[model samples]
Target: MATSGPVLLVSQAQQRKSRTYTPSPWGDFFLHHVPCTPSQLLSMKERAKVKEQQVRQIIHETIASSDLLHVFEKFRDESGAIVSGDDASCLLMLHDAAHARTHGEEILDGIVAWSKSRLQSLVVQKNLLEPELAEEVRCALETPRFRRVKRVEARRYIPVYEKKSTRDETILEFAKLDYNISQAIYCDELKELTIMVELHFWMLGVIHDPYCSRIMIVKIFVFISLFDDLMDNYSTTEESNVFTAAMERWDEQMAQQLPAGLKALLVRIFNATNKIEEELKLQGNMHAELIKKMVINSAKFYHAEVKWRDEHFVPTSLEEHLQKSIPTSACMQMANLALVSLGNVTTREDVEWVFTFPKIIRGACIVGRIANDIVSHEREQASSDHVASTVQTCMKQYNVTIKEANEKLRAVIEEAWMDIVQDSLEQERPRALLDIAINVARVADFMYKREDAYTLSFVIKDIIASMYIYSV
Candidate 1:
């Protein structure tokens, strides 16, 4: 049968509408609309570039004004050194804007090439400062520089926590994952990834505050992610296979190719996750521990559920098993991490009090992600005899379907956000940039399909927010 003109027009209109409404993390971070195809995306790049130029022109014109020049000098002493890295990065942003505007579709690719050179140069220049430090950095760089960069020689895993790599395989994996999930997601584009790394430098520049230099912040993210994965196994369904593939790609192949530093950094992330688990178990946070334990347990449940379905071994109803599996411990486990992350509030009571807020956020994340997975695999779910949190089962229990769950999840997330605001205000914390960044991550997470995004953001934001508020 031949397709009609009206159908084609309608299809085009829907596609356009979808692009506009997509909750993309990259779009949110860059403050632009999500792109649908390579061609459309190239067009968006040109548009972004043009806008960047306009921004640069405004900044240049402002700097040229006498008042601004005077203020810049006044802010510095007589033997004033050059502007700091923070300022340099800001200037780079302006430059990026101009390039984006001027270069059109070439802006992203050009910027990426430029950044790789810049990173290499930065490493070379650092070598000039101290040969020993530079050599150590180079060695580590040969390891795991994707999520982290090389730091001074420390035999023990020093949690380097940078950002992901920008290689083809990594990009392709992220793109495929995002597409398969049918949700707005963010992957580390070359520019964004560079900016994320530069952010570490920016913090060190503006506030040579020792805490800013500590390993605590990076470790927190790693721990929170592991904890989230443990607790939210149900939300994963078929989507887990995609992530598993990505991990396998990293371990089997990508790990072999990265700089020594990057490879070590990836190894450190896993070590850190295990360490956190040990510490939590020692502290007797049973709820959190159980979540980790249950990933393996849930798999067993699926196996048993399948056997029951096949042989009709009616030991207990599937509903009973499901209910038993979802322990009330999740709320408490989430609360523990949230309080710990909020730097200023460390005691048991402080953590206990904040537990309520984390629970709400956890629920939102689980429900939102689980619903998304079901929607994406609606047909697969129909065919599977036994699957965790499938749409059919979800509808049976809640009297609502996937879309309804997403809406409800959104409302829950909003409510928990207010609690976060209230907690910060009550604690009288200073809303530092780190805290704000954590909150931004939390908000940006809604644009992604990762179940961990919500849980990680909650812990990150709560911790940073509490640090500002509690002053500990």
Candidate 2:
């Protein structure tokens, strides 16, 4: 449907009415609530590391003598044996066992199968349980803690743990402190990101990690976000074309060709890329050149979307759209950032493996692209001169209604998730990169669950507060 000339005869800036985003609900609230100073946080981290080593050594000694099969049986007995008497503990065990069975580690598969069977029985008899316990049972059966990542489960479980008669004060206090500290770190990251007009975005994925290295990654996330905003929403086609060429060359002199706004944008882009390169190098990452290459490649992908918009191009089909869309989803770049952000533990092999854009990462990128497009299609089109969204391309290729196209795309999202789960269970890659890929996918599902939560920040105001603003 596009041509050499833009289909929209109107000036893009004239037609591109900006969306008014609200100030974050917890503005400046976190800056006031940081319980510990920077030095204290560092001390706490060091102490936590020491304690973790002690715990790991103890676990190693225990595992050497203990049979995991026998340990799993204890779960079977605890949950299955007294299901009528202890609703909460029994429900939790059955839930754990059921999900564990579905993922089904070979050694524990038998016990997990038994737990699913037992859990089904409890579900059938939920009528006799306390109302609250029945709800808990339903949630466990449906969403299950195993399906949730650590942070999500932690938020859900902390309250549940506190309700127990035997809840330990030390553990409870520790959980409170840990969550708040993580929240504080998130606030600090957000403050830096705000300078770039971003985040509460990246921290959705990096919520658990508080190291300074992650701030650099967050910077990249912000820069890319602003870069997209500039090209897709604000800049003229000619300006975007010029700026993209400058980026491709990565030459400072090219900035002279841009208008004032784009000139500053190009300078910031170079400065940010250089800083990331510098930081990665300082950590002894030998793959700095590759990282820079990825940054440029990602920018090129972003510009492809802009060019599509500029030409008013609808992709010939979904396949053509995805060729660029998947990479532009930011999954690959974030996965690369995740590798280096973890510090010196990243081996050359790890960097090489991630750079390959392995199967799991592709699946994750699919989910990130499609899931986001499904939720964000309207907002993006309205706020910017958006090219054909995933939905549009699907509709055009399949000749389907918007609802039907969305349904097909939603199926694609599930397929992508299946790929992620299957690949993760294989354990063929570095655990950290795989986990980060999964988290990137998780963030997509969450941030776009019912709305474009990132742009429509109010949708997740309570969530942001819970994760970063409020105490446990």
Candidate 3:
């Protein structure tokens, strides 16, 4: 196949200076410069260049060719291992092909399966390879680029590509510069958002990964944080009701008669949702329309809580409290957004399953709602106007002490988690989908385990700095 990109060249001076020697614990290793003919050195350099060129050709062919089977046939030798001799490059191609949206007619499926098996075998025997090559193999095996954390992958890949003589210097330089630029953008977005409403963007590193899916999830959480703040601190019962109705209508006319802050928030939500829908469409997800309904339902649930607070009506029963609070938790909406982030792996059936409010989804939301109540009820009670949390409702209905109510709520949280575990085992749920729901509960636990970490900026500053500010 004809390659489109310009060929890269490595200078002899640069190649000569690239060798390194490390002394062994045994002693003075004059072995570092074991006598070699100048011709031998030149031959080694040429062989390295040939291997690099082959690897780059494989990458280019995989990317440029529409017929994956033809590309696979050309790249693989009789034994079926990719002919590149660069395992990392082959692994990258396998990942890209596996993730391609070809519906059920995946031409690269056999290649992916073969590549995975071959890679696993190489990883097991990695001790036989050079230190750098061994590490590369280990990293690829540990987390394929498709699944690797985005920021970590950038940090890891830049040096690998830099060492490849066949890689265009301009491309390597661009990757380095892009990493710095992306980090700056993430920091700026997080800093402004943290000030407005406390949240830890630990997942920001995901921006470097596939389709910007991780950052999209972060964006959804940012909006969730802002919406929570507006509901908890700013809007009155009447104002919140009006805003909720407008959200349900989801039209420009609904923005009329709203306060400036609520109006601005509505616009942001609309724009964000529109952007998310566009991304979903590009990924070929047919259920993109469901995302808007999920968000609207979340808003309506928020309004229900506001109504209860406004009427000074605590639920008379635990069931009533759960029924009201679970949807309002917004975990389901977040879970659905998480599904959307999976791109081609998520089917319309997956979206429909989520909409059904299965055991796992319900369990996760219940855990989140009750966990928040457990940690934040005291602070929330200090506020003159506050919706009754699960803790308060349990305390009032059972005529129990605060400690007892908390204990009961904790048990409920435990039961909900069991429900998740049971559903995961029985239904053969998609691991990715299950993971998102599990993460929703995990985030809830992290935010509310000791206190409302999401509401308290200082509590998670160290975490933010370590994940985003400090390099790995």
Report the number of the highest-TM-score candidate. Answer: 2
The lDDT values for all models are 0.35, 0.68, 0.63
Ranked by lDDT, the better of candidates 1 and 2 is: 2
- Candidate numbers, best TM-score first, in rank order: 2, 3, 1
Model 3: per-residue Cα lDDT at residue 380: 76
Error of 2 at 427 (Å): 5.3
List runs of model 2 lying over 4 Å from the truth: 1-19, 26-33, 37-149, 165-174, 188-201, 382-384, 397-399
lDDT of 3 by residue, 1-472 (tens): 2442222112211211111222222122221212334565355455545555655776787689766456546766787654545455566566444532222423455555566676667666736566666676666554444434345456667877778777876456545545544544454444434432223243442123333435556666666655555665667555676788888888856777676877888888999888987887887877677777877776777777766665667888888988888887777877777677666577878877987789989987887799888887987777655778888889988999999999998878756766765676667767777767766665665566677666555675565544445433
Q: Write the per-residue lDDT of candidate 2 for residues 68-103, one digit (tens) a residue.
A: 565544443443542233455564665565443323
Whole-model lDDT for model 3 versus the true structure? 0.63
Candidate 2 lDDT for residue 188: 72
State candidate 2's TM-score.
Answer: 0.77
How many clashes show up per model?
Answer: 32, 0, 0
- For model 1 the TM-score comes to 0.28
